[model samples]
Target: MPIPSRPRAAALAVSAALLSTSLAACGGDSKDDVDLPSQTLSWKDCPAPSESEGGGEPPSPLPGGTEWQCATMKAPLDWDDPKGDTIDIALIRAEASGAEDKRIGSLIFNFGGPGGSGVTTLPAFGTDYAKLRTRYDLVSFDPRGVGRSAGVECEDAEQLDKYFQQDSTPDDEAERQKLVDNVSAFNGNCEKHSGKVLPHVRTTDAARDMDLMRQVLGDDKLHYFGISYGTELGGVYAHLFPKKVGRAVFDGVVDPTEDPEQGSLGQAKGFQLALDNYAKDCTSQVEDCPVGDTPQDVKDKIAKLLRDLDEKPIPGIFPRDLTQTAATNGIAQSLYSKDFWEYLTEGLQQAYDGDGKVLMMLSDSMNGRNEDGQYSNIQAANVAINCADDKPRYTPQDVEEKLPEFRAASPLFGDYLAWGMLGCTDWAVGGAADHPDVSATGSAPILVVGNTGDPATPYEGARKMAQALGSGVGVELTYKGQGHGAYDSGNKCVSEAVNRYLLEGTVPKEGTVCS
Candidate 1:
């Protein structure tokens, strides 16, 4: 169970809770002279993150002593009514380190979550993108309904702890009814606490915000880098602002053609594929595999563990136990990066012996729980944006009807993912469309990077995103690797090609392959 969050997020991005905002709602006619495209951002040293942004210390400076600066950009709360209410979109930046003449303006990043705090994430992974920063001021922000940007609140942290512990995959009609009740309560809490902003957190709204950001930053073209769900955002931006596009790369691309149900089904298959790969890698190791002697044995043991947990939970983090849902979530989180496979093996081995702490910790990470036992708004905003973007509202019957297909796609993750399709059930806001429109016929060559082993967003999506972007506008670059994203895998072939494209403006040949 996971999300479009670049990786390490729980299934179908479910769960959201209670928090409130003081974002002012204004009318179109106002005396305010400084609007978003015209407002001057006052950059200053970034303070430690707020609780909603996954509380952490301020970012350290780059290797060359370049400090990470923070700023707030104003955008209309509702894009349709341009002069209406506004929200503060938190931003972070590391000024280009190269000479002024060599600079290529800013590279705005959106690292998927639809809910991730870019203000925080960019710094956490600052060094990873430092090479690109040499010639471009690397910038990222908290999108509307996300952390520190008028974030959407639902249940309180305590309530969410209970929410995550409850059975998400219902086995009987009574359990199904209870599951629905829980979801409705969660959605109801969201409306009760943050109704004003729920209606406006669509992906299209974020895309327009990005355009305003590009203009305010004095960039004629929007040089961008998008990962996971960020890729979907980039596609929508390209579709809307074709001429303004420049040096864009989409990694772990989403299939822009699928509706909600189709997308979920694809993710089911993707996660299963990742599980299969993980199994093969583990058992094929030179040293004896810790979990199992064969790939099928590895998967079989995992399935049995889940079934057993469903019957009797095991001791996890003090006061909590690793239930079936948590175990499923933890396993999915580990699959996000191959580096985490060892942790999965360790957790699984420990679980076999009745210790569930490692697995629960992994699940906590997926749900954005810090070591202090507090939760972030990642799951909340993820639901807010995804719900507002996807038009389909599924009922239990719809899921029950589709369970067989999902299970066939992924025996381990099938039911977990199938049940996730109901995340938007009775949501307060009406979604914008069945799927995003990513047809940018006249845009520049936008590189679309697809990893063959990406779990959250499957490998097939790269080609779909490219094909949807229209002929020459989309340049497809394939990375034959594992993990949620290509460039982040530290593969030299993939990194060199992306560097040449983004830094030197040399798009790799349309079908270039990297391993």
Candidate 2:
């Protein structure tokens, strides 16, 4: 399955009042600050592991038998107190296969999750990045609180199963309390098991780590490719090291201007748009469309199915039954990419036939749960990073007041996504850190890619990011296609434009559109 870029929900925009202070704090280390150490990266053979070993399905053998090199770098656990303690950051590199004389510098990658492992994701893109790989060594790393690096592990598989089964859209006070209790319990567990690092996993901290990586790798400036949540990291990096920003591409851009409530509402509308597109395509293209003849009819059917599941969960292939939460997750996962629409059709058909195994499988895949009943730390890290970066200000009453607006934004997905903010209302370890607006003034041109039909991160967010980065520095490349990220979606025009930018340092003309 293609890794979906998880949305980084929190703020719409950074507080302008706090911007100057935070920028001063994060700006490239001053002469008085402690000089960062430079260490040689010892490249070693990449380990090849099976699906059960958290490697996902074994990637196809590298082209021309070119193997990846693995290494680890030390970074301060807390950026504020550099001498206190340190953690190892796992990194992988695939050296340029083209002529060294013509080779450009390393191209670092972050496949958004706030928690997704670049180690697992970058290699999978080897084929897609063939053009750029010839001129730049592709480097990817597990950010501070992500896979392979020190992670945030809140619950084991069993506990997580129960948590996922909880109803996100509560019907009454009792049910709402249950949702609150579950969120509180999850938050407490993260505080207990991952406390020391939870408060330090903010995007700014990870951006600092990236600067260290750039220095260690002997690059005068960083060339970055960040997707979805990764774009948040990239934006922060650009702001901190404006002079050092080199040929950065922020694909599926997240708008750093909206507050938490605005972000959620935007995402609600974005997902709704994607679902509407999917419904139209499904009804028109699929011979045996299971939903209905029209988009509204299709949505009605799905809404009814979710309501039915809420009333009585259906038994699945796994030991646990398919609850409304699981079914909703399954449906949302299918919205990430059109390639998965067929899977959604089949899963929905199976659900209507009283067998929820297919939908349950899709849900499990989204949650990073293996067939062996083990869960990855993706969710744990996702929550930890998001909560730490932007504190939730909405109370239960606040959400209630905004419920109508959320539902108006997305009738099918709004309630759950809005209420999802409840987890961070009282985060145990991390609070909202400064999320300064990113102008990246005086930086090299940065390309911002947006998919018109992207469900997560939404297309407008990309436009806003480009505008925020300053007219001269930020370039917006529009992909008038579906799915989340544009480069790897087999769109020749997008691929060519991005490749040209990365390889030749050529920015696409502003307002360039590729269909």
Candidate 3:
């Protein structure tokens, strides 16, 4: 989350334009219990924030630009009861500048990780988005159970260490029992400690939080961008309030209908596909590629190595005890971006020779272990959010049935990922079943962006999401490159297209592909 950064403010003396409208007219609240009809229409250009009336402190001062005000929006903990207890989500907005620049509504940004905190990343990455920040207010927040604003804290770091170190993939009955016990302990501790807020941290709840923020910002509709898990949150918002969507973008789209087990299974297959691609690309360039012989041979080598590590983790090479499960998982994560593939390929080659430093680093990043021997809140929150959002389809029969398929998909990783999904069964929070298919039929057009080679959220998921949001436009930017999120990946075609869409009220023509 910290890798991306944000810039500071330049005073345009922008006026805060409050566009207040009635929900009754918008069909946002239908008390008669009748389904409201959604109608698509052209989006209207809205005025920017009034520089004079931005009457609070200037944006929080940052390293580069001047910081604006930190605003808090009241959102429902549970969407079902609008009148129920509300939680305050803290937001930071950086205003744009230049007289020639036309100010649009707020552009809310979310970097994935159902657990990823965006507020921290905004200031960190604002400088890169300076031009866009000049056009619209760049806004982000620490969602519930995240940083700054009320976050969920667990039993101390020591307890967390044990939780993460627990074996993910079980090869034997004893290992499986250990995995199950660790899962149960971790979840039980969550219930014992953060149980009150655990149930309210689902993706749908986050979407509702976005709407409340939209209203607070005085925007009639939502202008949003979400990555990875953020796409799932955006999709839910679009589905629940399609009429409220405004210039929305969902990258690394997650198919809401897919259950946890299926979702993880799909991810396993996706990683395998990426690995295959990496193998082909690397082998073809033997001079640059450390991976040897053929793609099949490389795959076999990795499988063999993982099997060896499973039995006895190599000593003194890594910070944590190296296990076949952790190594493969780390490798899978590296596949998310092609830039990281070189590192992984090299790591694989080294590990094949008994050196595990490179592989260990990959493992550390995926598992969120830091040099200080601490874990990033990402791992905890990722597990909590995924488990809480959807129930695993992992029964004895289910695992038995899928074991071979997973193994076939990932010789070294299949069974391990399967157990990771199974760990969700111990989650205390109930699961989400209702998929709020975001049609946003009547609202401003939404943009669904997909990277063809995104490993985490495959391109197909983005295509399906675009199809689901009939009122939305799908901008297929073929990166031919590999990365989890593409718009910010420096692809001229992709960024330019997105900038044009956001700045002008134009949606790329339907099924428009930017290669």
Worst 10 residues of 3 by lDDT: 11-20
129-227 per-residue lDDT for model 1 (tens digits): 878988999999998998899999998889998888878889999989988888888988999999999999998788888877887677878999998
lDDT of 1 at 403: 97
Candidate order, TM-score descending: 1, 2, 3
Q: What is the Cα-based lDDT of residue 397 in candidate 2? A: 82
- Summarize candidate 2's per-residue lDDT along 1-515 as a digit string, tens digits: 11234632111000010111001112254222444444667888776532222444433447888887788888889877877798988888888889999888889998786677777667766666778889988999888888768888788778988988889888899998888888888888988988889889988789888988877776778999988988989988887778889889988888888766777778888889999998898888647567687888889988999999999999975689998888888787777777678778888888888888877877776676766677667778888888888755557788798899999999988897878768685587645643545778889999999999988788999988988888698899999988777887789999899999999888899999999
Best by lDDT: 1
Quote each prediction's TM-score. Answer: 0.94, 0.92, 0.83
Q: What is the lDDT of candidate 2?
A: 0.77
Q: List model 3 lDDT by residue over 181-245, tens digit each.
A: 77677778777877778888877677767766676565787888777777777777777776677
The list of candidate 2 runs beyond 4 A from truth reads 1-33, 48-60, 286-288, 433-436
The local distance difference test score of model 3 is 0.62
Output the number of the TM-score-best candidate.
Answer: 1
User: Model 1: what TM-score?
Assistant: 0.94
How many clashes (backbone atoms < 3 Å, residues ≥3 apart in a chain or on different chains) does model 2 have? 8
- Those runs of model 1 whose alpha carbons end farther than 4 Å from true positions after fitting are 7-37
| Per-prediction tally of clashes | 9, 8, 30
